[model samples]
Target: MDIKNVFQAKDVPEAINLLDQYGEAAKVIAGGTDIIIALRENHVKVSVLVDISSIKELKEIKTSDDWVEMGAAVTFTEVMDYFKGHKEYSGLIEAASLVGSPQIRNAATIGGNICNASPAADFVPPLLALDAVLTVEGKEGKREVRLEDFLLDKGRVDLNKGELLTTIKFIRLRKGQTVTFSKLGLRKALAISRLSTAVYLEIDDDEKCAEVRVASGSIGKHGLRERVAEESLKGKNLDKAAIDEASKVLSNEVEKRLAGRSSCEFKKDAVEGIFLKAVEKAMVHNGDGSYCAMGTQYYPRAAGKE
Candidate 1:
Protein backbone atom coordinates (compact mmCIF):
# COMPACT_ATOMS: atom_id res chain seq x y z
CA MET A 1 0.00 0.00 0.00
CA ASP A 2 1.52 3.22 -1.15
CA ILE A 3 0.61 6.33 0.84
CA LYS A 4 -0.40 9.36 -1.16
CA ASN A 5 -0.69 11.91 1.62
CA VAL A 6 -0.42 12.26 5.40
CA PHE A 7 -2.22 15.20 6.93
CA GLN A 8 -1.83 16.24 10.56
CA ALA A 9 -4.80 18.06 12.08
CA LYS A 10 -4.41 20.58 14.86
CA ASP A 11 -7.94 20.31 16.22
CA VAL A 12 -11.16 18.30 16.06
CA PRO A 13 -12.78 20.46 13.40
CA GLU A 14 -9.72 20.22 11.18
CA ALA A 15 -9.64 16.43 11.58
CA ILE A 16 -13.30 16.14 10.64
CA ASN A 17 -12.72 18.37 7.63
CA LEU A 18 -9.90 16.15 6.41
CA LEU A 19 -12.05 13.07 6.86
CA ASP A 20 -14.89 14.68 4.95
CA GLN A 21 -12.62 15.72 2.13
CA TYR A 22 -11.11 12.26 1.65
CA GLY A 23 -14.05 10.10 2.59
CA GLU A 24 -13.25 6.38 2.26
CA ALA A 25 -9.95 7.11 0.61
CA ALA A 26 -8.56 8.40 3.90
CA LYS A 27 -7.93 6.66 7.22
CA VAL A 28 -7.52 8.11 10.69
CA ILE A 29 -4.34 7.32 12.62
CA ALA A 30 -3.96 8.10 16.31
CA GLY A 31 -1.55 5.69 17.92
CA GLY A 32 -0.94 3.95 14.59
CA THR A 33 -0.81 0.70 16.53
CA ASP A 34 -3.60 -1.06 14.62
CA ILE A 35 -3.79 1.04 11.48
CA ILE A 36 -0.16 0.64 10.58
CA ILE A 37 -0.44 -3.13 10.73
CA ALA A 38 -3.62 -3.08 8.65
CA LEU A 39 -1.82 -0.98 6.05
CA ARG A 40 1.21 -3.27 6.03
CA GLU A 41 -0.91 -6.35 5.44
CA ASN A 42 -3.01 -4.66 2.75
CA HIS A 43 -6.06 -4.99 4.98
CA VAL A 44 -6.72 -1.27 4.59
CA LYS A 45 -5.81 0.42 1.34
CA VAL A 46 -6.05 4.15 1.89
CA SER A 47 -4.47 6.92 -0.09
CA VAL A 48 -4.59 9.48 2.69
CA LEU A 49 -3.72 9.29 6.38
CA VAL A 50 -5.20 11.86 8.74
CA ASP A 51 -3.03 12.07 11.84
CA ILE A 52 -5.04 13.15 14.89
CA SER A 53 -2.49 12.10 17.51
CA SER A 54 -1.18 15.65 17.88
CA ILE A 55 -4.62 17.20 18.52
CA LYS A 56 -4.59 18.31 22.15
CA GLU A 57 -8.35 18.52 22.33
CA LEU A 58 -8.72 14.83 21.52
CA LYS A 59 -6.39 13.83 24.34
CA GLU A 60 -8.16 15.48 27.26
CA ILE A 61 -9.85 13.67 30.14
CA LYS A 62 -12.66 15.58 31.81
CA THR A 63 -14.66 14.83 34.94
CA SER A 64 -18.02 16.29 35.88
CA ASP A 65 -20.55 16.03 38.65
CA ASP A 66 -22.25 13.01 37.09
CA TRP A 67 -19.85 11.48 34.59
CA VAL A 68 -16.31 11.27 33.31
CA GLU A 69 -15.51 12.02 29.66
CA MET A 70 -12.31 10.71 28.12
CA GLY A 71 -11.15 12.10 24.82
CA ALA A 72 -10.75 9.65 21.96
CA ALA A 73 -6.97 9.93 21.98
CA VAL A 74 -6.48 9.35 25.71
CA THR A 75 -3.95 6.52 26.12
CA PHE A 76 -4.20 3.52 28.41
CA THR A 77 -1.38 4.88 30.57
CA GLU A 78 -3.30 8.08 31.06
CA VAL A 79 -6.40 6.22 32.19
CA MET A 80 -4.42 3.95 34.51
CA ASP A 81 -2.61 6.94 36.01
CA TYR A 82 -5.82 8.92 36.45
CA PHE A 83 -7.66 6.15 38.28
CA LYS A 84 -4.74 4.60 40.14
CA GLY A 85 -5.76 3.28 43.57
CA HIS A 86 -9.44 3.99 42.83
CA LYS A 87 -10.87 0.60 43.65
CA GLU A 88 -14.46 1.32 42.67
CA TYR A 89 -13.62 1.01 38.97
CA SER A 90 -10.50 -1.05 39.36
CA GLY A 91 -11.81 -3.35 36.65
CA LEU A 92 -11.13 -0.68 34.04
CA ILE A 93 -7.71 0.07 35.46
CA GLU A 94 -6.89 -3.62 35.48
CA ALA A 95 -7.95 -4.10 31.89
CA ALA A 96 -6.01 -1.05 30.77
CA SER A 97 -2.97 -2.29 32.59
CA LEU A 98 -3.20 -5.63 30.75
CA VAL A 99 -3.29 -4.18 27.24
CA GLY A 100 -0.04 -5.34 25.62
CA SER A 101 3.09 -3.99 27.37
CA PRO A 102 4.09 -0.64 28.81
CA GLN A 103 5.00 0.77 25.40
CA ILE A 104 1.75 -0.43 23.90
CA ARG A 105 -0.19 1.08 26.80
CA ASN A 106 1.51 4.38 26.17
CA ALA A 107 0.46 4.28 22.51
CA ALA A 108 -2.92 2.54 22.42
CA THR A 109 -5.93 4.82 22.88
CA ILE A 110 -9.24 3.75 24.39
CA GLY A 111 -11.01 5.11 21.34
CA GLY A 112 -8.90 2.93 19.09
CA ASN A 113 -9.68 -0.15 21.16
CA ILE A 114 -13.42 0.54 20.80
CA CYS A 115 -13.11 1.49 17.17
CA ASN A 116 -11.27 -1.70 16.34
CA ALA A 117 -14.25 -3.65 17.67
CA SER A 118 -12.40 -6.90 18.21
CA PRO A 119 -14.31 -9.67 19.88
CA ALA A 120 -11.49 -10.06 22.41
CA ALA A 121 -10.69 -6.40 23.11
CA ASP A 122 -9.57 -6.16 26.74
CA PHE A 123 -11.32 -2.86 27.38
CA VAL A 124 -14.76 -3.67 25.97
CA PRO A 125 -16.16 -5.85 28.77
CA PRO A 126 -15.29 -3.41 31.56
CA LEU A 127 -16.62 -0.45 29.58
CA LEU A 128 -19.77 -2.32 28.72
CA ALA A 129 -20.28 -3.17 32.36
CA LEU A 130 -19.84 0.51 33.13
CA ASP A 131 -22.56 1.34 30.55
CA ALA A 132 -20.26 3.66 28.67
CA VAL A 133 -21.38 5.92 25.84
CA LEU A 134 -19.37 7.16 22.88
CA THR A 135 -19.50 10.60 21.27
CA VAL A 136 -18.97 10.48 17.50
CA GLU A 137 -18.15 13.53 15.39
CA GLY A 138 -18.41 14.17 11.69
CA LYS A 139 -19.08 16.90 9.13
CA GLU A 140 -22.73 17.04 10.15
CA GLY A 141 -22.19 17.23 13.91
CA LYS A 142 -21.68 15.13 16.98
CA ARG A 143 -23.96 12.37 18.22
CA GLU A 144 -23.82 9.95 21.11
CA VAL A 145 -24.36 6.20 21.09
CA ARG A 146 -24.13 3.54 23.73
CA LEU A 147 -20.90 1.59 23.56
CA GLU A 148 -22.88 -1.62 23.17
CA ASP A 149 -24.53 -0.27 20.06
CA PHE A 150 -21.47 1.36 18.58
CA LEU A 151 -19.85 -2.03 18.08
CA LEU A 152 -21.45 -3.64 15.05
CA ASP A 153 -19.27 -6.70 14.53
CA LYS A 154 -15.71 -7.95 14.56
CA GLY A 155 -13.50 -5.32 12.88
CA ARG A 156 -16.55 -3.12 12.34
CA VAL A 157 -18.13 -0.11 14.07
CA ASP A 158 -20.96 2.37 13.59
CA LEU A 159 -18.48 5.05 12.56
CA ASN A 160 -19.11 6.38 9.09
CA LYS A 161 -16.37 6.99 6.58
CA GLY A 162 -16.35 10.73 7.22
CA GLU A 163 -16.75 10.47 10.99
CA LEU A 164 -14.35 10.26 13.91
CA LEU A 165 -14.89 9.13 17.44
CA THR A 166 -14.48 12.10 19.81
CA THR A 167 -15.03 10.94 23.34
CA ILE A 168 -16.27 8.16 25.63
CA LYS A 169 -18.40 8.93 28.67
CA PHE A 170 -19.97 6.92 31.44
CA ILE A 171 -21.85 7.63 34.64
CA ARG A 172 -19.77 7.59 37.80
CA LEU A 173 -20.33 4.62 40.07
CA ARG A 174 -21.78 5.70 43.36
CA LYS A 175 -21.31 4.26 46.84
CA GLY A 176 -21.98 0.53 47.24
CA GLN A 177 -21.31 0.07 43.51
CA THR A 178 -18.22 -1.51 41.99
CA VAL A 179 -17.09 -3.12 38.73
CA THR A 180 -14.41 -5.81 38.49
CA PHE A 181 -12.82 -7.68 35.56
CA SER A 182 -11.28 -11.13 35.07
CA LYS A 183 -9.60 -12.56 32.01
CA LEU A 184 -8.07 -15.82 30.84
CA GLY A 185 -5.32 -14.98 28.41
CA LEU A 186 -2.86 -17.07 26.44
CA ARG A 187 0.00 -15.84 28.64
CA LYS A 188 0.56 -13.75 31.74
CA ALA A 189 1.55 -10.61 29.84
CA LEU A 190 1.14 -9.21 26.33
CA ALA A 191 -1.24 -12.01 25.44
CA ILE A 192 -4.67 -11.65 23.86
CA SER A 193 -7.57 -12.68 26.02
CA ARG A 194 -9.13 -16.03 25.30
CA LEU A 195 -12.18 -15.20 27.40
CA SER A 196 -13.04 -12.47 29.89
CA THR A 197 -15.83 -11.29 32.17
CA ALA A 198 -16.68 -8.02 33.89
CA VAL A 199 -19.10 -7.81 36.75
CA TYR A 200 -20.82 -4.67 38.07
CA LEU A 201 -22.68 -5.07 41.33
CA GLU A 202 -24.41 -2.83 43.85
CA ILE A 203 -25.53 -3.98 47.27
CA ASP A 204 -28.38 -2.33 49.14
CA ASP A 205 -28.70 -1.48 52.84
CA ASP A 206 -30.18 -4.90 53.50
CA GLU A 207 -27.22 -6.61 51.83
CA LYS A 208 -29.26 -7.69 48.83
CA CYS A 209 -28.18 -7.04 45.30
CA ALA A 210 -29.70 -3.81 44.08
CA GLU A 211 -28.11 -3.84 40.65
CA VAL A 212 -26.12 -6.38 38.65
CA ARG A 213 -24.56 -6.09 35.21
CA VAL A 214 -22.42 -8.80 33.63
CA ALA A 215 -20.55 -8.45 30.36
CA SER A 216 -18.44 -11.07 28.61
CA GLY A 217 -15.91 -10.95 25.80
CA SER A 218 -14.38 -13.37 23.28
CA ILE A 219 -17.42 -15.60 23.50
CA GLY A 220 -19.70 -14.14 20.87
CA LYS A 221 -19.67 -11.68 17.99
CA HIS A 222 -18.83 -8.90 20.43
CA GLY A 223 -18.85 -8.03 24.09
CA LEU A 224 -22.40 -8.61 25.37
CA ARG A 225 -24.31 -8.16 28.59
CA GLU A 226 -25.31 -11.35 30.38
CA ARG A 227 -28.87 -10.27 31.07
CA VAL A 228 -30.08 -13.67 32.22
CA ALA A 229 -27.33 -13.88 34.81
CA GLU A 230 -27.90 -10.30 35.90
CA GLU A 231 -31.65 -10.84 36.21
CA SER A 232 -31.14 -13.94 38.32
CA LEU A 233 -29.01 -12.07 40.82
CA LYS A 234 -31.19 -8.97 41.22
CA GLY A 235 -32.64 -8.50 44.71
CA LYS A 236 -30.93 -11.71 45.77
CA ASN A 237 -28.32 -12.23 48.42
CA LEU A 238 -24.78 -12.35 47.10
CA ASP A 239 -24.09 -15.69 48.66
CA LYS A 240 -22.62 -18.91 47.32
CA ALA A 241 -25.94 -20.26 46.08
CA ALA A 242 -26.86 -17.10 44.22
CA ILE A 243 -23.41 -16.85 42.72
CA ASP A 244 -23.57 -20.47 41.58
CA GLU A 245 -26.96 -19.91 39.94
CA ALA A 246 -25.72 -16.80 38.17
CA SER A 247 -22.69 -18.70 36.95
CA LYS A 248 -24.91 -21.42 35.58
CA VAL A 249 -26.96 -18.82 33.72
CA LEU A 250 -23.80 -17.42 32.15
CA SER A 251 -22.62 -20.89 31.17
CA ASN A 252 -25.93 -21.56 29.43
CA GLU A 253 -25.67 -18.28 27.57
CA VAL A 254 -22.16 -19.10 26.38
CA GLU A 255 -23.21 -22.58 25.32
CA LYS A 256 -26.07 -21.17 23.30
CA ARG A 257 -23.86 -18.59 21.64
CA LEU A 258 -21.10 -20.96 20.63
CA ALA A 259 -23.08 -24.16 20.17
CA GLY A 260 -21.53 -25.44 16.96
CA ARG A 261 -17.96 -24.31 17.51
CA SER A 262 -15.23 -26.69 18.70
CA SER A 263 -14.40 -24.39 21.59
CA CYS A 264 -17.97 -24.41 22.86
CA GLU A 265 -17.52 -27.31 25.27
CA PHE A 266 -14.44 -25.80 26.87
CA LYS A 267 -15.87 -22.31 27.03
CA LYS A 268 -19.18 -23.43 28.50
CA ASP A 269 -17.44 -25.02 31.45
CA ALA A 270 -14.81 -22.28 31.79
CA VAL A 271 -17.26 -19.38 31.85
CA GLU A 272 -18.65 -20.45 35.21
CA GLY A 273 -15.27 -20.29 36.91
CA ILE A 274 -14.39 -17.00 35.26
CA PHE A 275 -17.72 -15.44 36.17
CA LEU A 276 -17.32 -16.59 39.76
CA LYS A 277 -13.84 -15.15 39.98
CA ALA A 278 -15.04 -11.81 38.66
CA VAL A 279 -17.92 -11.76 41.13
CA GLU A 280 -15.64 -12.71 44.00
CA LYS A 281 -13.26 -9.87 43.17
CA ALA A 282 -16.16 -7.46 42.93
CA MET A 283 -17.53 -8.64 46.26
CA VAL A 284 -14.17 -8.21 47.94
CA HIS A 285 -13.98 -4.65 46.67
CA ASN A 286 -17.53 -4.08 47.97
CA GLY A 287 -16.39 -5.21 51.45
CA ASP A 288 -17.95 -8.65 51.46
CA GLY A 289 -15.95 -10.93 53.75
CA SER A 290 -17.98 -14.06 53.01
CA TYR A 291 -16.05 -14.56 49.79
CA CYS A 292 -12.64 -14.02 51.33
CA ALA A 293 -11.46 -17.44 50.18
CA MET A 294 -12.45 -19.26 47.01
CA GLY A 295 -13.72 -22.84 47.14
CA THR A 296 -14.89 -22.40 50.73
CA GLN A 297 -18.22 -22.46 52.52
CA TYR A 298 -20.17 -19.20 52.61
CA TYR A 299 -20.34 -17.36 55.91
CA PRO A 300 -22.44 -14.23 55.82
CA ARG A 301 -21.19 -11.55 58.14
CA ALA A 302 -23.50 -9.90 60.65
CA ALA A 303 -25.35 -6.78 59.61
CA GLY A 304 -23.16 -3.62 59.42
CA LYS A 305 -20.03 -5.72 59.01
CA GLU A 306 -17.68 -4.02 56.59
Candidate 2:
Protein backbone atom coordinates (compact mmCIF):
# COMPACT_ATOMS: atom_id res chain seq x y z
CA MET A 1 0.00 0.00 0.00
CA ASP A 2 1.38 3.35 -0.99
CA ILE A 3 1.11 6.31 1.40
CA LYS A 4 -1.33 8.55 -0.38
CA ASN A 5 -2.27 11.03 2.37
CA VAL A 6 -1.55 11.70 6.01
CA PHE A 7 -4.28 13.40 8.03
CA GLN A 8 -3.43 15.12 11.28
CA ALA A 9 -6.26 15.43 13.79
CA LYS A 10 -6.29 18.21 16.38
CA ASP A 11 -8.51 16.44 18.85
CA VAL A 12 -10.71 13.41 19.45
CA PRO A 13 -13.56 14.91 17.44
CA GLU A 14 -11.31 15.59 14.46
CA ALA A 15 -9.83 12.13 14.68
CA ILE A 16 -13.30 10.65 14.66
CA ASN A 17 -14.17 12.76 11.64
CA LEU A 18 -11.16 11.39 9.80
CA LEU A 19 -12.18 7.89 10.65
CA ASP A 20 -15.69 8.56 9.42
CA GLN A 21 -14.54 10.14 6.18
CA TYR A 22 -11.91 7.55 5.39
CA GLY A 23 -14.04 4.68 6.64
CA GLU A 24 -12.51 1.22 6.58
CA ALA A 25 -9.47 2.23 4.57
CA ALA A 26 -8.43 4.81 7.17
CA LYS A 27 -5.92 3.86 9.84
CA VAL A 28 -5.16 5.80 12.99
CA ILE A 29 -1.53 6.28 13.96
CA ALA A 30 -0.49 7.64 17.32
CA GLY A 31 3.06 6.59 18.19
CA GLY A 32 3.71 4.99 14.75
CA THR A 33 5.20 1.94 16.43
CA ASP A 34 2.76 -0.69 15.17
CA ILE A 35 1.40 1.19 12.16
CA ILE A 36 4.86 1.76 10.79
CA ILE A 37 5.63 -1.91 11.11
CA ALA A 38 2.36 -2.76 9.44
CA LEU A 39 3.00 -0.34 6.59
CA ARG A 40 6.48 -1.73 5.98
CA GLU A 41 5.23 -5.33 5.90
CA ASN A 42 2.25 -4.41 3.69
CA HIS A 43 0.04 -5.83 6.43
CA VAL A 44 -2.41 -2.94 6.22
CA LYS A 45 -4.38 -1.36 3.36
CA VAL A 46 -4.45 2.19 4.59
CA SER A 47 -4.89 5.28 2.46
CA VAL A 48 -5.44 7.95 5.12
CA LEU A 49 -3.09 8.08 8.07
CA VAL A 50 -5.08 9.77 10.83
CA ASP A 51 -2.42 10.91 13.25
CA ILE A 52 -3.77 11.64 16.75
CA SER A 53 -0.49 12.16 18.50
CA SER A 54 -1.15 15.87 18.75
CA ILE A 55 -4.38 15.48 20.70
CA LYS A 56 -3.81 17.21 24.03
CA GLU A 57 -6.58 15.47 25.95
CA LEU A 58 -5.15 12.07 25.18
CA LYS A 59 -1.72 12.88 26.55
CA GLU A 60 -2.40 13.81 30.14
CA ILE A 61 -2.11 11.48 33.18
CA LYS A 62 -4.58 12.49 35.87
CA THR A 63 -4.92 10.86 39.27
CA SER A 64 -7.79 11.99 41.44
CA ASP A 65 -11.27 11.18 42.71
CA ASP A 66 -11.69 7.39 42.64
CA TRP A 67 -9.32 6.38 39.84
CA VAL A 68 -6.07 7.11 38.12
CA GLU A 69 -7.01 7.95 34.56
CA MET A 70 -4.57 7.88 31.67
CA GLY A 71 -5.11 9.30 28.25
CA ALA A 72 -4.77 6.91 25.34
CA ALA A 73 -1.67 8.73 24.18
CA VAL A 74 0.21 8.27 27.44
CA THR A 75 3.60 6.75 26.68
CA PHE A 76 5.49 4.19 28.71
CA THR A 77 8.00 6.88 29.61
CA GLU A 78 5.16 9.04 30.88
CA VAL A 79 3.80 6.18 32.97
CA MET A 80 7.16 5.53 34.58
CA ASP A 81 7.56 9.21 35.35
CA TYR A 82 4.02 9.52 36.68
CA PHE A 83 4.59 6.89 39.35
CA LYS A 84 8.19 7.62 40.24
CA GLY A 85 7.46 8.85 43.77
CA HIS A 86 4.47 6.59 44.40
CA LYS A 87 5.11 3.19 45.93
CA GLU A 88 1.65 1.63 45.60
CA TYR A 89 1.90 1.80 41.82
CA SER A 90 5.46 0.52 41.78
CA GLY A 91 4.50 -2.74 40.10
CA LEU A 92 2.86 -1.17 37.04
CA ILE A 93 5.48 1.57 36.93
CA GLU A 94 8.18 -1.08 36.91
CA ALA A 95 6.42 -2.90 34.09
CA ALA A 96 6.30 0.34 32.12
CA SER A 97 10.01 0.90 32.67
CA LEU A 98 10.82 -2.63 31.52
CA VAL A 99 8.88 -2.58 28.24
CA GLY A 100 10.69 -2.50 24.86
CA SER A 101 13.80 -0.60 26.08
CA PRO A 102 14.19 3.17 26.10
CA GLN A 103 13.32 4.17 22.55
CA ILE A 104 10.31 1.94 22.09
CA ARG A 105 9.01 2.80 25.54
CA ASN A 106 9.36 6.47 24.76
CA ALA A 107 7.30 6.14 21.58
CA ALA A 108 4.80 3.42 22.43
CA THR A 109 1.44 4.62 23.76
CA ILE A 110 -0.49 2.74 26.41
CA GLY A 111 -3.61 2.86 24.23
CA GLY A 112 -1.68 1.39 21.33
CA ASN A 113 -0.49 -1.40 23.56
CA ILE A 114 -4.09 -2.14 24.59
CA CYS A 115 -5.57 -1.78 21.11
CA ASN A 116 -2.85 -3.89 19.50
CA ALA A 117 -4.05 -6.68 21.80
CA SER A 118 -0.86 -8.69 21.76
CA PRO A 119 -0.95 -11.69 24.06
CA ALA A 120 2.44 -10.78 25.47
CA ALA A 121 1.91 -7.02 25.72
CA ASP A 122 3.86 -6.19 28.88
CA PHE A 123 1.40 -3.74 30.38
CA VAL A 124 -1.81 -5.67 29.65
CA PRO A 125 -1.24 -8.18 32.44
CA PRO A 126 -0.58 -5.43 34.97
CA LEU A 127 -3.61 -3.38 33.96
CA LEU A 128 -5.69 -6.52 34.02
CA ALA A 129 -4.57 -7.18 37.57
CA LEU A 130 -5.44 -3.60 38.31
CA ASP A 131 -8.96 -4.27 36.98
CA ALA A 132 -8.74 -1.31 34.66
CA VAL A 133 -11.50 0.40 32.69
CA LEU A 134 -11.23 1.97 29.28
CA THR A 135 -13.48 4.81 28.10
CA VAL A 136 -14.00 4.79 24.36
CA GLU A 137 -15.52 7.57 22.26
CA GLY A 138 -17.48 6.97 19.08
CA LYS A 139 -19.91 8.86 16.88
CA GLU A 140 -22.69 8.06 19.30
CA GLY A 141 -20.81 9.22 22.39
CA LYS A 142 -18.72 7.28 24.90
CA ARG A 143 -18.76 3.82 26.34
CA GLU A 144 -16.75 2.24 29.13
CA VAL A 145 -15.59 -1.33 29.21
CA ARG A 146 -13.42 -3.35 31.49
CA LEU A 147 -9.89 -3.76 30.25
CA GLU A 148 -10.19 -7.55 30.37
CA ASP A 149 -13.19 -7.47 28.07
CA PHE A 150 -12.00 -4.67 25.80
CA LEU A 151 -8.92 -6.76 25.07
CA LEU A 152 -10.59 -9.87 23.72
CA ASP A 153 -7.94 -11.70 21.65
CA LYS A 154 -4.70 -11.30 19.86
CA GLY A 155 -4.91 -8.68 17.12
CA ARG A 156 -8.51 -7.93 18.07
CA VAL A 157 -10.44 -5.56 20.33
CA ASP A 158 -14.01 -4.56 21.18
CA LEU A 159 -13.90 -1.11 19.67
CA ASN A 160 -16.45 -0.03 17.08
CA LYS A 161 -15.43 1.27 13.66
CA GLY A 162 -15.21 4.91 14.68
CA GLU A 163 -14.61 4.36 18.37
CA LEU A 164 -11.40 5.93 19.58
CA LEU A 165 -9.85 4.81 22.81
CA THR A 166 -10.09 7.91 25.00
CA THR A 167 -9.18 7.24 28.61
CA ILE A 168 -8.04 4.34 30.75
CA LYS A 169 -9.05 4.42 34.41
CA PHE A 170 -8.61 2.13 37.38
CA ILE A 171 -8.84 2.16 41.13
CA ARG A 172 -5.75 3.39 42.89
CA LEU A 173 -4.75 0.73 45.38
CA ARG A 174 -4.92 1.70 49.02
CA LYS A 175 -1.92 2.12 51.34
CA GLY A 176 -1.66 -1.46 52.70
CA GLN A 177 -2.51 -3.30 49.48
CA THR A 178 0.12 -5.20 47.54
CA VAL A 179 0.75 -5.30 43.81
CA THR A 180 3.56 -6.84 41.74
CA PHE A 181 4.48 -7.18 38.06
CA SER A 182 6.81 -9.73 36.44
CA LYS A 183 7.81 -10.70 32.91
CA LEU A 184 9.77 -13.48 31.20
CA GLY A 185 11.24 -11.81 28.14
CA LEU A 186 13.94 -13.92 26.54
CA ARG A 187 16.47 -11.20 27.39
CA LYS A 188 16.74 -8.27 29.79
CA ALA A 189 16.04 -5.74 27.02
CA LEU A 190 15.15 -5.42 23.31
CA ALA A 191 13.24 -8.67 23.48
CA ILE A 192 9.51 -9.33 23.33
CA SER A 193 8.16 -11.09 26.34
CA ARG A 194 7.87 -14.89 26.12
CA LEU A 195 5.37 -14.60 28.99
CA SER A 196 4.40 -12.23 31.77
CA THR A 197 2.41 -12.24 35.01
CA ALA A 198 1.05 -9.66 37.44
CA VAL A 199 -0.53 -10.18 40.81
CA TYR A 200 -2.37 -7.72 43.10
CA LEU A 201 -3.23 -9.17 46.44
CA GLU A 202 -4.75 -7.19 49.29
CA ILE A 203 -3.97 -9.01 52.48
CA ASP A 204 -5.85 -7.80 55.53
CA ASP A 205 -4.45 -6.90 58.92
CA ASP A 206 -5.34 -10.34 60.25
CA GLU A 207 -3.08 -12.02 57.64
CA LYS A 208 -5.97 -13.45 55.62
CA CYS A 209 -6.24 -13.03 51.88
CA ALA A 210 -8.88 -10.35 51.27
CA GLU A 211 -8.66 -9.56 47.60
CA VAL A 212 -6.45 -11.21 45.00
CA ARG A 213 -6.24 -10.95 41.23
CA VAL A 214 -3.88 -12.71 38.83
CA ALA A 215 -3.34 -12.11 35.15
CA SER A 216 -0.95 -13.74 32.66
CA GLY A 217 0.25 -13.02 29.13
CA SER A 218 1.94 -15.03 26.33
CA ILE A 219 0.78 -18.27 27.91
CA GLY A 220 -2.36 -18.29 25.75
CA LYS A 221 -3.90 -16.74 22.68
CA HIS A 222 -4.61 -13.63 24.78
CA GLY A 223 -3.77 -12.57 28.30
CA LEU A 224 -6.56 -13.48 30.72
CA ARG A 225 -7.35 -13.82 34.36
CA GLU A 226 -6.58 -17.03 36.20
CA ARG A 227 -10.13 -17.49 37.49
CA VAL A 228 -9.49 -20.82 39.08
CA ALA A 229 -6.35 -19.55 40.74
CA GLU A 230 -8.17 -16.49 42.04
CA GLU A 231 -10.88 -18.67 43.44
CA SER A 232 -8.36 -20.91 45.17
CA LEU A 233 -6.86 -18.13 47.24
CA LYS A 234 -10.04 -16.31 48.22
CA GLY A 235 -10.26 -15.73 52.00
CA LYS A 236 -7.46 -18.20 52.57
CA ASN A 237 -4.72 -17.95 55.16
CA LEU A 238 -1.47 -16.29 54.14
CA ASP A 239 0.92 -19.21 54.19
CA LYS A 240 3.56 -20.84 52.06
CA ALA A 241 1.38 -23.84 51.35
CA ALA A 242 -1.64 -21.79 50.20
CA ILE A 243 0.47 -19.61 47.97
CA ASP A 244 2.07 -22.77 46.56
CA GLU A 245 -1.33 -24.18 45.67
CA ALA A 246 -2.42 -20.97 43.95
CA SER A 247 0.80 -20.90 41.99
CA LYS A 248 0.26 -24.49 40.92
CA VAL A 249 -3.24 -23.67 39.72
CA LEU A 250 -1.94 -20.78 37.62
CA SER A 251 0.75 -22.97 36.03
CA ASN A 252 -1.73 -25.74 35.30
CA GLU A 253 -4.26 -23.28 33.88
CA VAL A 254 -1.88 -21.82 31.32
CA GLU A 255 -0.44 -25.21 30.38
CA LYS A 256 -3.98 -26.40 29.70
CA ARG A 257 -4.70 -23.53 27.30
CA LEU A 258 -1.40 -23.17 25.48
CA ALA A 259 -0.64 -26.86 25.58
CA GLY A 260 0.52 -27.36 21.98
CA ARG A 261 2.18 -23.98 21.54
CA SER A 262 5.95 -24.33 21.13
CA SER A 263 6.63 -22.22 24.23
CA CYS A 264 4.06 -23.83 26.51
CA GLU A 265 6.46 -25.92 28.52
CA PHE A 266 8.91 -23.08 28.95
CA LYS A 267 6.14 -20.67 29.88
CA LYS A 268 4.67 -23.13 32.33
CA ASP A 269 7.94 -23.30 34.21
CA ALA A 270 8.34 -19.54 34.00
CA VAL A 271 4.83 -18.93 35.31
CA GLU A 272 5.58 -20.96 38.41
CA GLY A 273 8.52 -18.78 39.24
CA ILE A 274 6.79 -15.52 38.32
CA PHE A 275 3.61 -16.33 40.22
CA LEU A 276 5.49 -17.45 43.31
CA LYS A 277 7.65 -14.36 43.23
CA ALA A 278 4.65 -12.04 42.81
CA VAL A 279 2.79 -13.65 45.68
CA GLU A 280 5.87 -13.69 47.89
CA LYS A 281 6.45 -10.02 47.22
CA ALA A 282 2.83 -9.13 47.92
CA MET A 283 2.83 -11.10 51.15
CA VAL A 284 5.97 -9.50 52.40
CA HIS A 285 4.72 -6.03 51.60
CA ASN A 286 1.18 -6.47 52.90
CA GLY A 287 1.01 -9.75 54.82
CA ASP A 288 3.15 -11.10 57.61
CA GLY A 289 4.94 -13.39 55.14
CA SER A 290 8.53 -13.76 54.01
CA TYR A 291 10.31 -15.23 50.99
CA CYS A 292 12.71 -17.15 53.27
CA ALA A 293 9.66 -18.68 54.90
CA MET A 294 8.25 -19.63 51.50
CA GLY A 295 10.80 -22.47 51.29
CA THR A 296 12.19 -21.48 47.89
CA GLN A 297 15.73 -20.83 46.72
CA TYR A 298 16.74 -18.98 43.55
CA TYR A 299 20.32 -19.46 42.41
CA PRO A 300 21.80 -16.87 40.10
CA ARG A 301 22.90 -18.55 36.90
CA ALA A 302 26.04 -17.73 34.93
CA ALA A 303 26.06 -14.86 32.50
CA GLY A 304 24.12 -15.43 29.26
CA LYS A 305 22.09 -18.06 31.09
CA GLU A 306 18.78 -18.41 32.94
Which model scores highest in TM-score? 1
Off by over 4 Å in 2: 285-306
**lDDT (10s digit) by residue, model 1, range 1-306:** 789999999999999999999988999998888889999999989999999888898899888989988899999999999988778888999899988999999999998888988899989999999899999999889899999999898899999888999999988877677888999888988888899999888777566788888999999888888899999999997778889999998899889989899999999999999899899887643354343211111235432253
TM-score of every prediction relative to native:
0.93, 0.91
Q: How well is each residue in 95-200 modelled by candidate 2, as lDDT tens digits?
A: 8988887999999999988888888888888889999999999888989999988876778999888789999998976755656787777789877878778887
Highest lDDT: give the candidate number. Answer: 1
Clashing pairs in 1: none
Q: Evaluate model 1: give its lDDT.
A: 0.86
RMSD of 2: 6.6
Write down the lDDT of every candidate, Cα atoms only: 0.86, 0.80
- Alpha-carbon deviation at 170 in model 1, angstroms: 0.5
